[model samples]
Target: MLAERPWTGYGFESFWGTPLLLNQDQPFDRAWDIRTIVHGHNGYLDIAVLMGIPALCVAVYTFLVAPLRDYMRIPLRKENIHLGDFFMMVVLFAALNAFFESFFFHRADPVWLFFVFGMFGLRQVSLRPMAVRGRS
Candidate 1:
């Protein structure tokens, strides 16, 4: 059982237990990236890129779609928000992300998981029926 332990010191090269993105002296390449799966460290930039996609999706729906309904005189909050539609969109985005990741990267990265969860929250917030008060 002792043989199972990683003694090459390649296990933990960074803070805590995980390596700092790639090893300190490793080089990054597009061709290599296309062939292998290695988690690289982008610091906080990675977080922004991962979180930005769902936020932009929600922002577009809110600022563009929601306001257009107002100009078109569509009812704002009268009818209940359709739960099925919201759930379907979230599933669609998640599936798309998964399929693309699997095809190109050969594995579903944790970033995709974050995008899926973020999409759910975004749709729920954007599709919520807001109460509109009448003009006094």
Candidate 2:
């Protein structure tokens, strides 16, 4: 129960340490309680069914479009289109967009669409000069 001490004292430091039901005589079993089981199942189902598509879209755009934009922007030799650069761009874009969406939009899934568009727009702007210079 809520009033009972946690089996592992480590959780006692936080508000989550407080149990929902306070019955001092009841023991905290290692088995999943009804409430915990239901909540976790529902949460997993929601994420998998509702949020999975957008998350996948974000991941693909971060790995594909972002790097293509960077490649078009940087001036490199004809053979310098390395996979490392693309991978780094993907990681950077993912981290940047994740932080921005988490802190600012409070939605980590759909915000990558904005980043994808913005990156493509910026790439277009940057590509003008390179195209005119016979580079791209």
Candidate 3:
């Protein structure tokens, strides 16, 4: 629904309380922009956000970078990679984040969902297929 860079920030407040979305307000900057700020005051949601790190790692292997080729239950076929899948992945990650922020967090966040996802691609080890067990 909303579109903004991960680094620049993407929060509900930034969307509603800033000039970019709301009129008559100055453009947001890293500093002096109250709407872009977030705090971990929420209980379980705060913990859930922290839990995302490991979930994401598994998602990447499941959806994009299945390193253990043989053991991977249903690796996304390389030939089947599609632009839609990319967007879907981002949406899935964002939805997970939004659940925490909107439900238990009791606060909103401008989380960089795609940033860590992208980093997985950038920093991943070789994608060369490997068998977890010997060829019996």
**How high is each candidate's TM-score?**
0.24, 0.27, 0.20
lDDT of 3 by residue, 1-136 (tens): 2122322333322333445434445566535654444434442233334334344355445434442342233234442233324544554465455444433223343444353443343223223322344468
CA shift of 60, model 3, Å: 25
Instruction: Report the error of model 1 at residue 48, Å.
Output: 26
lDDT (Cα atoms) of all candidates against the true structure? 0.38, 0.41, 0.39
TM-score leaderboard ranking: 2, 1, 3
> Ten-residue segment with the worst summed lDDT in candidate 2?
37-46
lDDT of candidate model 2 versus the reference: 0.41
TM-score of 3: 0.20
Instruction: Give the Cα error of residue 54 in candidate 3, in Å.
Output: 34
**Candidate 2 Cα RMSD after full superposition onto the native fold (Å):** 13.0
Best by TM-score: 2
The digit string of per-residue lDDT tens for model 1 on 42-70 reads 32222223334444355345434543343
Candidate 3, residue 105: the lDDT equals 26
Model 3, CA-based lDDT: 0.39
